[model samples]
Target: MEESAILNNSECTRKCSENLSAVEDAIYVIGGKWKLKIIIVLQESGNIRFNELQRNIQGISARVLSNELKDLELNGFVKRVVHAEQTPVIVEYISTDYSRTLKPVIMALSEWGKTHKRNIREDAF
Candidate 1:
């Protein structure tokens, strides 16, 4: 192999490694069974109460939902609002503008998921 070829390969490997690191960081923040689902619901529903959000995400326990909400809030993906003055103290979760940055990622995943489902069904025949 030429020296230039070796150098090019090293650079390509470094770039690939860096890209994997970026993916890992994103997963750390938003990659879970419940986090993305919660984000999707909040983005679609505007400000939603805790119980309502829990119901929207069928099968998630309240404890798990609360923990996911805290993680999302900590990562700047969701915000918790409290209407303390109201008689019952309404609390709501809202998606942050920052979370909208995931729109393209979510769309890509949706497309890929559809494609994967189609391929699986075809193979099952």
Candidate 2:
């Protein structure tokens, strides 16, 4: 069952509404697994090339990463810059002001995960 369906009462319903709105906002920019990972990679380095992003994010296909970058650019979460002066033009991805705001949110989640995550056997992977 979804988390939204579990809040049954009126009071809980209001809280659930608020939670759902916040989740919507959060997911608007950070919806997919690779998108969040891409943002985190961009945060660590101010800008990166397509191949770099592909290498950093494990198991993501080139086509999927390309789609994710396009979606992020469309949403204003990431900026794509093409160098016109280069002999062969190159493209770089940079985080936008809107995406920069998510840094604190990512950091907070990282801290929380570190503190509360359960131990699992390496063999389970």
Off by over 4 Å in 1: none
lDDT of candidate 2 over 1-125, digit per residue (tens): 45556645666879999999999987876786789898888878888999998999999999999999999898888899999899689999999889989889899989877656543433333
Q: Provide the global lDDT of candidate 2 against the true structure.
A: 0.86
Measured against the true structure, the TM-scores of the candidates, in listed sequence, are 0.96, 0.78
Which tens-of-lDDT digit does each residue in 20-113 have in candidate 1? 9999999999998999999999999999999999999999999999999999999999999999999988998999999999989999999999
- Candidate 2 displacement at residue 70 in angstroms: 0.8
Q: Give candidate 2's TM-score.
A: 0.78
lDDT of 1: 0.95
Candidate 2 weakest lDDT stretch, 10 residues: 116-125
Give Cα distance to truth, residue 9, candidate 2, Å: 7.5
For candidate 2, the C-alpha RMSD (Å) to the true structure equals 6.4
- What count of clashes does model 1 give? 0
